[model samples]
Target: MEGPPVKIVALAIQGFVGQVLLDAGGNAKVNKQQFLHQVCKRIHSIGKNLFFEFKEKSFKLHFLMYGSYRVNEEKSR
Candidate 1:
């Protein structure tokens, strides 16, 4: 089945961290594509954050910007 494409755009905020996007409500549209926009629409940040590109019945996530992060570190390096 073919239908109109869904467009989603999101902007990133500076120094924004510990964010999440949870689709608690299941898909209500006819198909997955219709309800997938919520992924990018529902985001918590200073300005804007989180993005998605719906393509071929799928989606691609993109991080416009990121906060500084490190792992595997000791108390004193």
Candidate 2:
């Protein structure tokens, strides 16, 4: 089955938080602050990877077999 429509996706990601978490093997030269206030130009997925593209940077998210995510909802710790 297909996923939700693109318009719904866009509305869900309308803002950006000014933080980035890098992997242990990720590029050391990348400045995480560069993403602050930068607009997300596009969003797409390839295979199991989800990509968020900015003007000068992009990040990819890949979930493990049982990984999951929540949007606009807070989980009590």
Candidate 3:
């Protein structure tokens, strides 16, 4: 698939959020299910930018001026 569907977006967001909240020195920690629920509760958001880091790699997704979509996913990169 070129541009992933909304489901993929949701999955990616969930993963990103989970990684961002991984084991910390404090006690405020959440499990996977709770994280997903809390994240999905954000019914609204602004901007077309998303970013995350995993392992030693980083990712940044920008939906462009048109909207949160991609007609040519490769070129968009």
Candidate 4:
């Protein structure tokens, strides 16, 4: 099945406050709390990795096999 359109994903996250759960990979020294209250400028993906772009910084999220994510959803017990 095809996933949602990129524009839809962007609309869901763009201009919304975001949080970082872990430091970004490679040499980037991204503080986990740095994204707090920052508006997400855009969202894109390459291969299995997703990216969240901000005004001065961007983050990458690499999903492993079978990995999944949810937006605006409560955690299941």
Error of 2 at 47 (Å): 0.5
lDDT of 2 by residue, 1-77 (tens): 12333334434655533333222232336565666567667766565556678777887756546444556455557
Alpha carbon deviation, residue 74, candidate 3 (Å): 14
Query: Compared with the true structure, what per-residue lDDT tens digits does model 4 show for residues 1-43?
Result: 1234433544566545455433222334566467655666667
Tell me the lDDT of model 1 at 71. Answer: 25
- In the predicted model 2, the residue pairs found to clash are none
The best-first sequence of candidates by lDDT reads: 4, 2, 3, 1
Q: Which residue pairs does candidate 1 place in steric collision?
A: none
Candidate 4: segments with Cα more than 4 A from true spot: 1-31
Judge candidate 2 at residue 58 and give its lDDT: 87
lDDT of 1 at 31: 47
7, model 3: CA deviation in Å? 13
Q: On a 0 to 1 TM-score scale, where does candidate 4 land against the true structure?
A: 0.59
Q: lDDT of model 1 at residue 42? A: 41
List model 1 lDDT by residue over 1-77, tens digit each: 01111112222332222232233222224344353333332423223333332232323232334422122333354
Maximum-lDDT candidate: 4
41-70: candidate 3 lDDT, tens digit per residue: 221122444443444443344545543532
TM-score per prediction, in order, is 0.18, 0.55, 0.29, 0.59
* Model 3 TM-score relative to the real fold: 0.29
Better of 2 and 3 by TM-score: 2
